[model samples]
Target chain A: MASDGHPSRGLPRSIRNAGWYLLLSVLSVAVLYPVWMTIVRALSEPFVYINEGQPFLPVAIDWGVFNTAWAEGVMGRSMLLTLGVTAIITIAQLVTSMLAAYAFAYLRFPFKTVLFVLLIATLLLPIEVTLIANIRTIRELDWLNSIQGLSAPFLASAFGIFLLRQGFMGVPSELRDAARLDGFGHIAFLRKVALPVNRPIVGSFVLITALGAWNNYLWPRAAVTEQRWETIQVALRSISVSRPERFNVGVAAAIIASVPILVLLIVFQKQIIRGLTAGAVKG
Target chain B: MSLSASAPIQAPTRRRRSSRVREALLGYSLLAPAFIVLGVFGYYPLYRLVHFALYRPNRFGNGEVYVGPSNISSVLADEEFLDGLWISVKYLLYTVPTGLVIGMLLALLSHRRLRGIKVFQAIFSSTVATSVAVASVVFFGLVNPKIGKFGDVSFISLAKADSALRGVALTSIWQNVGLTFVIVLAGLQAVPDAVIEAARVDGFGPLRRLFRVTLPLISPTLLFLIVILMIFGFQSFAPMEILTHGGPAGATETLVFKIFQRRAPGQISEGSVMALGLFGLTFVVTLLQLTILNKRVHYGE
Candidate 1:
């Protein structure tokens, strides 16, 4: 089965391998073009491309755009803000979802099925539809100009709880019974037994949820009225859309904003890929 | 004496059952904080959406504000709202199929056991990490024509509505293609070699095999992707706000964009109605797709 090509007998496997490599190289170029262009623009003068009229490559390379973005807090301040917000949201969401999931998976309570189903139903409703009312609520709470407002509403995600509940249900019943017999309380059993065993799943959920929070634009934009508290995504938007004429500056800002996510993807590509596949597998 | 001892044993059993109930109640208590948050933020706003959409506050009395029949009529009657709906529908029509196609193409290309499949897969998927705003900005640079990478190309200006939509769609499709590929590739890998062998033995050609076997087997996955993609398409806002700004002439103003503008902190009446409209549109479309795809997809053993 490995070498059964009838008409391609004249062509060696080495030649075939070369052809595949060539095709892949062309693909690699196509995939990397946008990223390469972004880097080139980010490192160049603000109006160099505009002045040159048709510079495919940077005419004058400098770190001025990064400097500008950092000074403007688009890169430096917004990046830190986004990171902090993402971290807090991820941690809060994880803990909440894990605890709720443990209850659903292990505890026997009245109306358990009904409540769990109700929680899961929220997944079907588009959160965007509720944005207006949510904003109003946030304003009322005086959380309109703070990170607490930005992250609070979204910290209790039905999707996260659902995913973790499914993960928790896969644990054997005997393990829980054993922990119970050993005098572990419900919360203690969950933290010491269920959680430690499902580290991979917990890690996957954290990465995916963090990505969602990091990339979230609408809620943060709607809730955070103060410009100083802007996340990197919102900051990027302010730079790009608000200053449409400054093509180089806008592009530079975009490059700065995207680099962190790109770096994260590179570092966790394998886990990310696995996690993505896992979502599709059961569906 | 034995009967008396047996009768007494049941008392302890009942007490133990009560203790179990207490423990379970404790678990529920521990879970209360998260549930309260979910209820107020997640469930409450959804319920309020209907109320807000229906009742136009006395603050802005156009008497035409009640939700009963007038609000629905007003939503359907507004020309700008209709236009926004049209644009969003057009976007969905273009984006959903295009994403699936491009995803399938990329997945197929990289699915083979080749030296660079991993590298290509990684690069193709890099777009998944980019937010909508970032994608919009990158494409904005590309199609600037006056100062873009393709500035020399005559067809690059975003001033034209069609061109703007096309540009946004292209960037969107590029960013989304990676995730789609990753998703479909998972489905493809799950196809058993024995099934392919059997199909080959039955004298079915590659194309036939793909359509008849591979597609049917992966229908569940494809359906999931389609539903998710259409939902994402309807929710598209950043691209419009950042890339085209509803463009050359409100060509790319999606329903979500209108909802955003209306609900902009101060004016709540029109925005509430628009938000309700957007919600209805998404809900109906999602449910319709789910029902339609239900007949086609078969989750198998």
Candidate 2:
């Protein structure tokens, strides 16, 4: 058996490979079929689609629905608004987390251990747990339907601090000594050395934070009472639910709402995966 | 020279002491922004939630009435709250294992050393793009009794009280498949090829190698996935909100949905109680996984 090219109790190598490929291909189709159907349904004329018994393929193509959904749903405003909120949250998380992580990883100060513990403790009280009170707080501050209410509660993330501290701790002590000897202060060292060395971790955190902020539903749904303040996710809901007669328009809105994040995922696929598994897979 | 050296050393000691104070100041300043935000928004609300649970707003709408721990007991005894908890548990049962198995299968399939495997991996993980809102809409359309692809499937009939949860669960499973697949695949990739090769040399078949060798090696990752998926299961709201609206009867009304419904002005106390109950449930489950299950997880030396 060792003398032959084939292994023990095995078919030819090509056949085995083919079998695996076939299985993988089938699974991929199963995974992708729903999304493809959605795309078809969104692009097809509803009457023709129903007339054709909702065949998998589009019977009559309509480019106008995308425009209609965009206008009717006020999706453009929501997209821009959501993008602004996402940017604010992402940038704020990065800055705050970096500052906190730097202190935890590199600085020595009073109550440092206590503060780190306090930060981690926030994880236990997710937004769901504190939603009723937070809404009151937002109302008391007169921040309802405002970006402040939308972005403030999430501006700082304990998970971000934890992830970043892990990354920064991996920065070599020798490098820190070298930076100090060169007359670099803490901020200078952080900007020039620590962040650059931990680019991938930072990148992962940024992508995930942006994704989370963009797709946020519950908070935005509760925070904003006005149609103008609605995020894309909430707006899509109104579009779909408010006009059940124009189902294709709703589907088109969903597709539009998803396209930006889909493009981000494709472009930064590696960073997204790394971010998601950062906790499970140690560096 | 001795006097000069002593003077210099004493002066440097004073300078070093002052510098330590400066360093502490800088560190505190760096930590201030995050702490303030977390305190006001994150920690304070937690305190307020507890306060709200124990006190209800009086009829004047200005002052609170001290109700003590009565709210907790009342909420606990409520049939709807209990039903919500049960539904949440059912949801957990429906989503977690199914997600784990599908994720595991997809990972194993794509973990092969074959050409164009990355393409398949991308397709498999593509659902990570679909948010809760998008997924709810997609599945809502998919499961519609008249226009849906699965309209004729008896088991997934949304109009039936008993089977509606299954429909919502199907949406959750599909939406979560990408995340589970990505994490599990990462775990599988982390397994060294040399170990698998050695298992083969020991005459271990693929299935035996997977169960006995590979699975044990990746048990830590599996545990992580399970905990995460469980938390996700409990947090699920959008699917129920959009697809079923807790429908036909109240079969799909998970705890989060119930909490959302209790958000009305008069029901804040009750909602706070329910919210705390949810927190307690999540806390206990997570602690169990980390404490008991963690003992069985394999961490290679």
Candidate 3:
């Protein structure tokens, strides 16, 4: 290091290093500012900035918003309902996807490739496009105003199967053969060999599926008809629409809706990052 | 090796019949639950939507009554439908390229090695965790007509110019910029460092290397990003619902909102048609993207 310390070389290196540090600090602030604003608004007195006409900063903090949001805001009830729906959908989709992925990845059959391609191709079909017809189907099943109406539609994700199949394919064939030689059946082999090895991918899918379900607004909005049957997202919309004047309350509701996701991010921040970036970057 | 070696020998002959049976039964059984759900929830509704789109709702409001081809012609002929489609197209034009450019820029800046870089990356993707409702709320407050930063600022509000559609679109771009940024950053990171280094060694500048080296390498990720963005954009509902309520006078009435508005709780037929219309639009976009980029994707480790 000392040998490379020519005066000109060190000068440029120091300058560039400082420049990089400065740029990163600026970006970090830009990223954190919105989150800080949300937190401030949530914790502060209702319409503090609006009433005072002061610059939008948290000068005073109040915890009443949380109490109000919990008691009067649709956050608590809708959140529980949303969680229940998300859990059922996630579990159902996971089981269905895992089994389908196992069959697709390991099973040998006529038209396997065709079936797999068709399955993956369905990913291109956005849920919105299918909503009109699916709604009708739900009505036909008399599923309206019920959990079955909400949870029945998205129980199988083609995208999940595709992701899991890729994970399964990465497992070595020797493992499968070893299971076979031990007189283990296909289900047992999958449980012993595939599931255990691909637990991380499975876990990632669970997180993704749950997040997708939890953040879901349109499908739940479309399916659940009754006001009380609303998901957190639908409830938030209702609150904002009804009380456009209470800017602080709306922000509180927004914060309330965001808390679960924030908690989830803190708990499973690693998995979310990995899941998001996996398709983009190589290890 | 020995297992494969054995695969071609005794196991094949001994287990062939049973394996075939096991495979067949397991294949259908595994698929059964999904297939039933898909059929009931997906395919069945698609059939009904198509069927209902050809019909007129009964005057008595009893149920959908088939009038055949006329309703389709009417929907096609409707000026409102045409305008809606045009508005949607305009939204894509504004959102897609702007999102990509902004996303790429953010990703490039944040993808570098710096102190607390992970935190910056998290912030960049934090929008993914924010629901549309929440994001819209933030923007709504910021763009408050009276007291908001942009609203009181005058210069920022001028671009909005009392048009809720343009206003909501601007807010949407702001809210969603983070999402596309995260996705594209992932794509950018997937580009190998070796390739970038080679380009640099060849005397290519940063911009040149980005265009020549990085862009080509990450085309698949870009395509994937675009498809996902476009789909979500088309399906976007809550922002329009919450921010403008599709209003001053139906300026932000998007495809999804239109479907929801057209159908009542049990009006499956009309709902299905609108839903199918959205599906058809997205399906075409997906196929177009695949066709355009399929040859360019270099699948490798």
Best-matching candidate per lDDT: 2
Winner by DockQ = 2
- The predicted structure with the larger DockQ, 1 or 3, is 1
Off by over 4 Å in 1: A1-10, B1-12, B59-68, B150-157, B201-204, B285-298
Tens digit of lDDT per residue, candidate 1, span A72-128? 654787788889889989999898898887777766667777887677666655657
Error of 2 at A263 (Å): 1.3
Q: Give the C-alpha miss distance for residue B280 in model 2, angstroms.
A: 0.7
DockQ of the candidate models in sequence: 0.45, 0.48, 0.43
Off by over 4 Å in 2: A1-6, A48-53, B1-12, B288-301
Q: Residues A132-214, candidate 3, lDDT per residue (tens digit)?
A: 66766677778877888888888998878877887887787677667667887767777878889988888878988888888
When sorted by DockQ, best at the front, the candidate numbers are 2, 1, 3
lDDT of 1 at B184: 90
Error of 1 at A267 (Å): 2.3
Chain B: TM-scores of all predictions:
0.83, 0.91, 0.85
Number of backbone clashes in candidate 3 = 4
Model 2, TM vs. native:
0.94
